[model samples]
Target: MRTSGVLPDAFTCSFLLKACVSLLDIANGKILHGVVEKLGFGSNLFLQNMILNLYGLCGEMADAMLLFDKMPQRDVVTWNTVITQMLKRGDIEGASRLFSRLEEESGLRPNQVTVVSVLAACADLCALDLGKRVHEYSNRSGFKNNVLVCNTLIDMYAKCGSLEEASRVFDEMEGKRTVFSWSAMIVGLAAHGRAQEALSLFSSMLQDGTEPNGVTFVGLLHACAHMGLVDEGRAFFTSMTRDYGITPGIEHYGCMVDLLSRAGLVKEAYEFIMEMPIKPNGIIWGALLGGCRLHKDIKLAEQAIQHLSVLDPLNDGYYIVLSNIYAEAGRWEDVTRVRKLMKARGVKKTSGWSKITLDDGIVHEFVAGDESHPQAEGIFRKWDELVVEMMLRGYVANTSLVLLDIEEEQKVKFIYRHSEKLAVSFGLLNTPAGTTIRIIKNLRVCEDCHSALKLIAAISGREIVVRDRNRFHCFKDGCCSCGDYW
Candidate 1:
């Protein structure tokens, strides 16, 4: 059109920019941005908002900010564009700073879109104070009755570790709670170990005529798994389709595998996987493999390895899990062979790590070979102290769970390298005396690490909550809240 001497208007330019965003053509998007500037439509609020949106969609925060800064007269949409963009890019700090600046300098009041975006940032950062402030802002701005804003507030509070506040927001919602609202509460309750409440809320969701979607079922399944309600889990698994006409997806199947496996029904879990309507994915096989490790079912563990290797040939966790299974079975030769295969395939196991929030509200993370922190030496020394204290509290590290072909001493070294232990040790050093340590891991917490954590919790007189890939384990006084079933 430009070449034909028919210059595009602001609306035309905005449409083209949206098209570029949809196609994810950042190069073409920049070209369009230049065209908008040349056409003198760059200052148009609508066109500028489109540019902001395009930059955000492309994850080009710097470009978006530059555009935002150049805009002379900004509207709520303009601020929402930049704030939402920052949130999506995981720049919570940038989003918060901009929000503060908008209120202080721009004098532009935030709308529902702005509130949603800011709430999302708060949730991602786990910034409880910021979230509460947003909550107050929403209330003062009369957005407290907005269902979308209320739902987001519920989610923000829940994710930030304030279930009571989440419940309060949930209860005060005058509007009909949507499925998402129910999901947020269910997830929050399940995550915080309020499994029964989660399940009850799920039932209430259905009774209130809100049809439970796949996510709702997933949350219910998770609650059932946490409570060891295998019968309820299985019933829900079937009811998902039979009663609700919702087909069971990979997530549903994954939850079922977790539920059965955690109940020590390893063989049944394996059989269920074989019978899945869809071919079992890596997550399903991984769950069964995890169950095999927990129950020490070497024969089934070997069977699980065959499925896992074929399903996820490139994932190193399968190889590591299989090797461990062989080690647990006392098959050193098999372990050696598995190691050789891993070497030949160039499969490197993923390093495990954990994160903990200190008393000062700073999150410290640790992984194997982590040396970037300023107090690395002090952290290691604290680790040593915890090791001694743990042993004094009758904590015997379960080296047998290492599933290595190495001697006992080597196995002990491997256990110490676990991500949970590193995070716990760091927590001990950074937190105040008697402060509970909450660590979240991306993988399953090894049995040895679990036992050691219990001992550490007792010796230090601090509660410890560890959220692994599968479930939550709350440790206090040398015992886990899960009753060792997980």
Candidate 2:
């Protein structure tokens, strides 16, 4: 048609752009962008939105935003397209800000798609306040009964450290609940270490005539692993194949290894891996190594490391865990050797960071010894005050995991500055006395921080909820939800 000098109309360009989006053909999309502009169809809202969709779907957010900014008008689809893309790329805060703009400035109420996307961002950031506002909006808009929105609400509430709310949402869904509703609640309960409750829910799910799927088993296996119910976990694993007719995937296998490993069946877990039909991945070996670390199985840890070094060479956490294990065993020479190996391989430890969402619906982040926040001085001062109370409450910092050859006091100081500690102190200073403090961490919370938080919660008379790399730890009255098993 171009060779015959037949000019493409807005509909023709829209059809071609839709095809580009379907095929993820960004190259052709760019060429068509020029064609649309050259053909004087640039002002056509339908064709322009299609081009934006092509850019967003193809991972060209820069171009999408460029086109979006230049558009004089945008409908709900336009905002949803950009916001969903932001989510796919893990830009939770960006998506949240865009949702804010949509609410405050766009003069348009968000549609169902926009609400789901914003709820996802809220869940990821643990922005409970913003999530609650969105939930209210859903109710006002009559979207509360919508299954997809309700499912997302369950997930959001659970991750935000409000299991009570999550359960309420699940119960309300009742006849409307899908398999995902059950699975999401199960997984959330498992992550919170309410394994028995999670399993009981699965029983109810089965009784309700909901057929279990692979995801359901993953949640069940996770529950069993966390509860240290080896026999029960094994039964569930076998039942997946025998009863449910579901072929266990890598995640299932990983959960099994975690269960055996956590149960101190290191050798059995190893043998289990050797006998697997599919090849084990780094997560499989990493689970074994974590068990070794817990049980101090040095020999097995070394073997796991051998496979880990090849499978995930650049992963610094593995090297660090190995070194810590060596340090725990008082094998200074082995620790030194591991450090040397890491240096030789140019692997650096991943920096741990923590983020906390305040009532204002903004997420604030911190690193170990972070002084970047505007209230850094107040945060540090509050921590100093908490240290006095914590010490009075018998909070002696456990420096056993601190590998550095330093004085005991120096080790304690090092422990004091971990990212979670900073985030908790910030929460204490910023929130009211009785408000619960919620924190999300990028790495496992160190033992020292865990112990300190228990005492902090006791002394502050506040509940502190922490979600780390593995699971949730809710501290209240000088006790953690995991019973220190994690």
Candidate 3:
């Protein structure tokens, strides 16, 4: 068309914009944006929406916002496009602000798509109050029965830790719930530790003629794993392929590995990985390594490390886990060799960190040597007191897991510097009395930290729930919900 001395029209530009989005060619999209401007079609509603969507897809939030702001007329699709883009970029505040301004400033009423997008943003940010407000608006606008809206509401409520509200939304939907709807509810239940409810809901979903999908099975399996229902997990794993015709994917395999590993079936879990039709990825092997750590199976842990190292050569977590395994098994030589190999390969250990949401809804994060908080000194002092109490309760400092050749006293100090401890101390200092402290760790919680949390929960009389990469550990009343298995 350029050779013919004619520029592409709006429709042609829209098609090219989609191609650029699919290919993630932001530069080409910019070139098309110029073409659209030069052709005097920038104001065309459809073309503008397409450009907005393309920028959003490419994660160019700034450009998408500029386009959205310049649009002469805004519709529901335009609003949804921009809001979804903001949510995708993790700009929850900006998305919420825009959502609030849409009706009053732009006279644009949010439709189901807009509501779903906003609800998803709420879910990602765990904005419970905003999610509840959106739910009320959805009801007032008579979109309560819209399946997509209701499903998103369920997901939002679940993610915001409002499982009851999620269930209410699930029950109130008028039509037969779809697989996604059921899956959302199941995921909610699983996340909230309502394992039996999740299983019952899965059975009900099956009975309602909604065939279970991979996600549904994953949720069900996770529920079973959390509840220690090993036989039920096995049956579900078998029924997934045999009865439902759903080939087990890597996620399914990972869930199965978690189930078997958590059930003290370390050897069986290792064999299951070998029997997988697809090559086991880092997640599956990592699950097995975790199991080995739990069961103290040094041999299987070593085998898992070998496979995982080859599968993810650049991943530092594998080395960390393997070194910890050797340390746990008192194989000092192997630990030393692993350390040397890591040093030779220039692989540094990734620092573990955890986050806790305070009463004001602000998430405070901490890592080793985190001195950024205003109350760091006080928090550390409190941590020292808790460590003393823990020691008196027969808590031995486990220096082996640090994978370092430091002195025992230094190892104890290092344990105090762990991210979870820092986060827990921060929670103690900042939160009111008896407030439950929920911490999320990026990696597995080390044995030292886990024991410390148990002590903290007991001494402080605070419920401490730590969600690590693998599973949830609820520490309360001097014990962990995981039975020290994790």
Best by lDDT: 2
Off by over 4 Å in 2: 1-36, 39-41, 44-47, 50-66, 85-97, 100-108
lDDT of 2 by residue, 1-486 (tens): 989988888888888888888899999999999999898887888888888888888889898989999988888988888887776665666776787798688898898888888788778877788788889988998998999999999999988889999999999998999999999999999989899999999999999999999998998998889889899899999999999899999999999999999999999999999999999999999999999999999999999999999999989999998998999999999999999999999999899999887766567889987878899898889899998988887778888878999999998888888999999998988899899999999999888898999999998999999999898999999999888888
lDDT (C-alpha) at residue 414 in model 2:
84
lDDT of each: 0.80, 0.90, 0.82
lDDT tens digits, residue span 365-415, model 1: 778657677887887788788888777767777887766458998877777
Tell me the lDDT of candidate 2. Answer: 0.90
Candidate 3 ranges beyond 4 A from true positions: 125-129, 171-176, 203-211, 339-348, 356-363, 374-400, 427-439, 454-466, 473-483
lDDT tens per residue, model 3, 107-150: 87888777887888777756666677778888988997888898
My TM-score estimates for the predictions, one after another, are 0.83, 0.90, 0.85
Worst 10-residue lDDT window for candidate 2 reads 87-96
Off by over 4 Å in 1: 1-12, 81-90, 124-129, 174-176, 203-211, 242-245, 297-311, 332-347, 357-363, 401-414, 428-436, 459-461, 476-478
Ranking by lDDT: 2, 3, 1
Root mean square deviation (Cα) for candidate 2? 3.0
